[model samples]
Target chain A: MNREKVILLVEDNPDDEALTLRALAKNRITNEVVVAHDGLEALDYLFGAGEHEGRDTSVLPQVTLLDLKLPKIDGLEVLRRIRADDRTRLLPVVILTSSKEEQDLVAGYSLGVNSYVRKPVDFVEFTEAVRQLGLYWLILNENPGRV
Target chain B: MMDRLFSLRVRVLVLVLLAVVPAMLLMLLSARDRRDASEESGRARALQLARSVEVDYMHRIDTTRSFLAPLAQVFALVPNLSNVTQTACASFFDKLIANTADIFQVGVASTDGTVICRSPAGAESAASVAAEPFFTTAMNSRAFSVGHFEFESVTQKPALHVGYPIIGPAGTVTGVLYAALDLNAISTDLGKTADPSVSFITLITPTGTILARYPNPEQWVGKEVGTPPSLAAMESGGPGITRESVSLDGISVVSATVGLANAGASEPGAGSISALVSVGIPKDQVFAGINDRLRDDLLGLLAAALLAGGLGWFGSGVLLRKLQLYVGTTRRFSEGDLAARAGPPYPRNELGALGRSIDDMAVAVSERQQEIQRLNEGLEQRVADRTAQLEAANKELESFSYSVSHDLRAPLRSIDGFSQALVEDYADVLDDEGKQMLGRVRAGSQRMGQLIDDILQLSRVSRAEVGKEEVDLSVMASGIVDDLRRTEPHREVEFQAAPGLTVTGDRRLLRIALENLIGNAWKFTSHTERPQIEFGAEGGPGKPVYFVRDNGAGFDMAYAGKLFGAFQRLHAMDEFPGTGVGLATVQRVIHRHGGRVWAEGATGQGATFSFTLGGSS
Candidate 1:
């Protein structure tokens, strides 16, 4: 177990962010979560630029839960930028959006997302989805360290 | 065929020839008749001239015989030889020869063939007369005899000698008295009355020797001629005979001949004389007048024919020019100029009527073309406007669907999530009713979210582009049924699908249609003791009617029409949980593929939903 395993949550809606955090906590996932209000903030936290300046640029999230609709740069553009960079290109990204639109799913996958999961309106289903995502990426899925 | 092969000019020429040929033939026939009449007239004129010459010769011969008969009587009365008798006979002959114009000489010969007396005494007045033909003929027959033409001693001119035998009182022949008739006097009398058309006049003896001729008589007189065989016809002495032959001078003439009968012979039974009189009209003079008329007539006919032919050619040109106008108009029409016409300056004839008819047809055709063009333009504009309106409606629908997918679901998620947190985190303070209310709020918010999702799905089906491929509807139905079974493992639903339900359509759209139809059947059949669902096809190839049938909670047939309408539910939510949008989405997919969907049902019995894809199976 890597004690510094971090989860990135990119969401523009405060209510959805709160719901997602509660869902992860309820699933007993104890990894430190870095919350970004929008696509640009998520990119800033990962690259240690903007408000996250002077931070360790080498540190990357274990998994990124991306929302498709966000303020500033959209989720698809942020994912494109993440894949474009060598440090974050191979980072595990799961699209956790309130949209089940096929266009968003296709665009998310086309931009090199690791998984696409639609956010369920049922709170229980949302909690179960987060728990499975944490188990698969933080524990069961093999990761190249520091890549 | 003739009209196609020949032009209008040729036809007109043919018509002119039709009029000309028979007219020329008739004129030629009349000209031939005129030529025959002229020849007949020329022959008649020659025969008349010949008859006139024969009459004059016969009258002169009769006159000479009358004079000689009386003179012979006078000599016979003084038969005894005496000098006084000879002198008296000589003076009497001299007085007789001087009184008569035709008689040039008179002489007396005794039976012993010596000249007893002579008048107009010449150096050869005592010449022997026994060798004279007239003297010998008169002594043998004792009749008046006509002699051959010879030169007289007294006159030295051609003359005919005639002799008379004197009979003594004892009824025996005594001496012969003869007279020479001057042929010049006879020829001069004939010449004064000769017809101008007569080219030559000839007098011939029985021996075929010409005694006298009028023109150039010196060359022709005393010459023996081979009498023309045609002169034999005149020997019968009925009428003169005319024949066309070459004369002694080699001029072609139509000659008429008449034989003169012997007259004034002492014996009544003396052989008849066969002296012939011939008059010749040269052939050039015979035909000259008629030929002139014929030449003028032929020239006139030729000029008329030329004038008619020239007029025909010119008239045909005028007619052909009128026809050419029609041809040019028709050619322009074929080249797509519908406005071309053969009219306005029309001739006042049948051709003008035809031109007007052609112009009428052109006007109708041009108007019809313009009308069709106007219709075509109107149709194109309508189609363009309809396409633009369709595009705008589709754009509005797309944006609306996008908003439903993204913004509408977020609030539902927040509502349900917070309700869940209340129920979970505040368990001790919250009463069971409070927790139950939170659960109800969560259910309502989740149901609203599901409704939004269903609406989005239906809109997406409407907006998505349909792609074509072969899809096995039966296999897809089976797959959907298997999924239903997996989702509700405890439910004992009997699902059966017939195989080989294949069709050509958008595979993804058809799959979505099939899922909804079969899913509806599955959900409707859940409460039955032995729930049954079936997927199969009916109808024929290329237009197969597919159906999903269920034997579960069936609605009344009265509400069947509303089955495919969006949000029109026949069953309550408690009985069958749905957004009531599935059938609408299925209907949209079927319609997008150019098909239709319908449902049939009876209360407490069953429902069968049937559909067809456009023209593929």
Candidate 2:
């Protein structure tokens, strides 16, 4: 159960990725954190393409942390694609962005993002955000059954 | 020259008066001369009558003397003087009297002034004249003598006595012979004139006694003559006419008078003839002679004057009608009706030319005004276009600011996150200075993030859709102050918020603005020992100026000018730790609602933030 409890983080910025990983690690969230540097890469991993071509497409993560600013498919578009697909329609996705712009948050939520969170500029606040997210999604939140 | 300024009718009248007045005066003068000439002709006629009377009298006296001489011859040659008896003389005298109309009696008297044989004999005829002066003078002088005027006893008529003495063979006067000459026949002879056209012809004595008068010879033959008022000029036996003279019957007349003595009278009667012949014409009759021509000429002149006046009036009426129309046009044009035209149907003379000029000027002015109006209208469009361009530019700027704000936060977040991670992850290797430096970097990046957020908030409120509603500011202020207390729970701050404070505005924006105000008050009063904050709407109902007041360290009024400016701070950063954008955001939000915000406070004293919403309470 713990092995299957995985978290995916789609982020383009290396610093944000490193900081997010550090925060997750410092919070002792031992769930597997699958890191994708771009929205396309993350989509590829989620749909079992490219390097993860042979991976079981049905083995989905418990939660997806989507970053809005990306190199290839933006976060909102990825969420739209994910929601359009029957397999990932019920999956929980949280939007994470350095910009706390209201339009982005609203768009993310309208596109079926389960939650929206801003990347705090402070390490302590980021850690606490990560810890609470981990505790709720990895431990308490019930996940969809594998199709 | 002066007539030119007057209207045509007046000018016509004036010109006619000027031309006709002198001519009328000349006619009057000529008429007076004609009257005087008529009067002179009348005087000449009277002089002629006087001359005729004088010649007749002188001839009659000579004839009488000749007859007496013949008689003296006849009587002296008679051989028997005693044989010339009264019967013979009487028959001879009767024969002589029958031959002459003027001879009333012809008789021979004795040298002793005895009675003479008289024709148509009356009793005592010789005795009646026996003591007469003329008989005595004839007997004594023994020459022909004409006696004074007398009344014949038998005829009882005025007459004159002419006597001739009989001469003896010795050439001494023997007896006196005399004849009585009737003067009444003079008036009868005067009545035989060819025409009695003049008013009267009178023969007057020098004593103002009339001996004969014409046209009624028998009535005034022996009366006193009619006298003129100023007879001094004509009384000298001179021939003259007196204007405004009165006649014998007291009628006003133009009279001519002549002394009969001026006519050819011989020595016997030269100084003794005091008779005058007066021919007088009444002025009424004199004027009546030329009245028809005068009346006709005057009527012609009057008719001409009326014709001129009527022509002037009629012609001027036509001209003035057009002028009045032109006047109306001018008045309308002056009153700003540029479309007014002076003429459509008026005559095309000077007035019409003026009308056309006025219309042309009006057209030119109207065209110019239309051009100006078009320009003004174009100016409005240009202004609207310019405003639209400015609005587009402002829109571009707002979107740019929004995007800038959105993008700027990412780098600040990265910087702050990394700095904080370095301090936390590398805690064992970092010294106090390194850690503090990293902490400073974290704080600066975080502070920058906060400024970006605040700036974005201010910009958002600027462009935000104002969804107006009745927002209970009292509730909003209470909630904001409660949140502030919860945020700084350890602080001993007192808060008071009045209830039922209402206003109309966007609740979201108002909440943000009030939060800023309350937060500012809370932050500024942190140093006050007994800090009290009051959040309530002030002023009268329907218009409340909501204020968040706190007993805190206030700022000097000198810095009030910069109080609402972004990033402007009165206290040092360490003393009042904040992004310093709260009040700016508040001001922007309040301003977006068409309200304004201001603060007043002293150092270490309370500060108050007051704001007013637009239109609605």
Candidate 3:
């Protein structure tokens, strides 16, 4: 059931997005990764509106890797909306970004992100970080969706 | 010079005396003038009294002479006195003596000193008239003569004898007619006309004999009046002379004496009888009233002056006390006690008005002080508002840095990550130089990331709030050294951090500062044969200069000014690889703790980084 659960990747920059996907592939995280380019697109996908209309909204991600900087509706606002909605209130969210700013970490935690990781510049370190995240959330940890 | 001594009381006393003294002097002057006028009037009164007494004496003598003149003419007409004519004269003389109270005796005497006829028959007659001065004077001078003053044997009263010479048919003196006038009777008559202020009236002979004295004729009539200042004046024979002297009766008197005119002098040589009339008024009696008034006026004036001086002295003291209170209150207010006031319970006079004015000024000054204080507070509020605006701008800058940290690093990571991926995955397609170029790109991107991280850290140190706690610098340095050792366990570096080195500052910031300093010491000393790093402090507590020393590739003293600048490195990247921001971060952290940081070194010798956490250390 955890293997069938989805991963949400909310990112804005294409380079960072491509690097992140490549890192996930290198780590062998076989779970389906749903890509949302901006904060607004991620929210739309979660609630099954806009381009994701007619999609089932009850299906929640196993883990959401959210970047703080985005084009539309910013990441903290999307997090606020996700936590405010009862459907995605308990969903495990991870903050994955290049920034190690204190405000960003504090705001991410305060907004109910379960895990926080700085995306390392070295591809090897990035691949290792993604492997740990995938093994912990998908294999070792029990899914709240099964409950 | 004596201004302090001349207090209000003294000034008031001086003013009082200034007002009183002139009045006192004027009063004294007027009193003196009054005394002079009183003395002049007294002398005039005494002179007048003496003149009046003299007139009475002369009238008596003139009356006697006139009565004798007719009888002499009668005798001159007959050569000898017949019994019929003598008997008729005797009867007439008796009648005259009985009628006249002034004449005590009347007689006719021959030149041979035989009594021819007597008016009073039973009276004892002197055997010879030849011894009598009046008879001799009248016979020799052929004129009427007045005798010296004497006391008669029978009456024991003073008298003056007057004689007229009788001329015969052959023009030789034959007989004399003489009369003795009672001086007491004359004095009694004069007393009736005398002034009541006159203490004594005296008839004095030219020889200084008291012929008669009024009020006590019997005691003084035959006594010689000693030549006192008054008697000497009388003997000078002036018409009238006044003297202030002690009289025969031992009374202080202002006496005037005048010589009486000899009314019976028929020739120049016949004017031998010189007499005087003197009147004395007691000196005290003359000026007693004026003296009494002057004394009373002086006493009253003295009392008034005393009262005025006393009022000025003590009254001014009262005013001075209040004035001092006002002065003290004003001084205190000026000296910054804005609440100081000349408090309540004011006097009801001009002094009170002055006090109220002072209090009003104090209140006004206090209000002005309050106004100034309020203005200062308002200025402070404006400063606080400006500071808040600056903080907002700073917060915006921090957020912008945060965005840069996030956005700039993402592309950097991609560049490095992709270049790494290309080196690993596309190894066959890439030539060695191409692969080397990608490796350079990877190194450049990684270095950029490191620079960005170090810049963010320095900015974080700038923005961070410094928190205070006990930070053991030696322990912190040892811990950092331990971490460095663990990273490169094979390096046999000698670390010497002073034991128990401590300070009071922001713990995290101090730790970070020590980490940077000690870390630099460790890194710079890595190439040395036997690397040694020493962390210690000098100076006193709370003012210690902490030092991190390293036997390493030290910097030149010439470039010391640029040592702590961000991105400033003394050595090349290949020699001692660093981001060149460690010392800058250390400087920032030390500065945030209100401290100073400095570096000392000689190239290739060693380096020492020293810092002081200001006074808070």
> Scored by CA lDDT, what does every candidate get?
0.82, 0.75, 0.83
Computed on C-alpha atoms, the DockQ of candidate 1 is: 0.61
lDDT of candidate model 3 versus the reference: 0.83
Q: Write the per-residue lDDT of candidate 1 for residues A20-133, one digit (tens) a residue.
A: 999888877888999999888999999998999988978788889999888899899999999999988899999998777677888888889999998888989999999889
**lDDT per residue as tens, model 2, B45-142:** 65565566666766766776776678778887765454576776787788777877677788777777766566764435546455766676677666
Model 3, range B172-193, lDDT digits (tens) per residue? 8878988889888887876787
Clashing pairs in 1: none
Q: Which stretches of candidate 3 lie over 4 Å from their true place?
A: A1-6, A39-62, A71-92, A110-112, A131-147, B1-14, B77-88, B97-101, B204-210, B216-229, B232-241, B246-251, B259-276, B292-381, B615-617
Better of 1 and 3 by TM-score: 3
Kindly report which residue stretches of model 2 are placed more than 4 angstroms away from their true locations once superposed. A1-147, B1-197, B203-252, B256-278, B285-316, B327-338, B343-357, B457-476, B496-516, B535-548, B579-600, B608-617
User: Model 1 segments beyond 4 Å from truth?
Assistant: A1-4, B1-23, B33-400, B422-444, B539-543, B552-562, B595-605, B615-617
Per model, state how many residue pairs clash. 0, 7, 1
Give the per-residue lDDT of model 1 (tens digit) for B1-617: 23742466676667777877887787778867876786788788888888878777777778988988887787668756334356666777788789888988888888877877778643355657888878888888878887766777666677888888988888788888888888877777767778676788888776777778878777877788866565556555456687788888889998888776654345322235546788888988988876787788778877877787788788767767778788889889979999798878988899888888889889999999999999999999999999899989888887678777788888888899998888788899999999999888998999998888888888889888888888888788888888988998998888889998888888888888888888888888878889898888888775788899999888898888888899989888988999999999999999999998999888878889999878475
Candidate 1 docking classification: medium
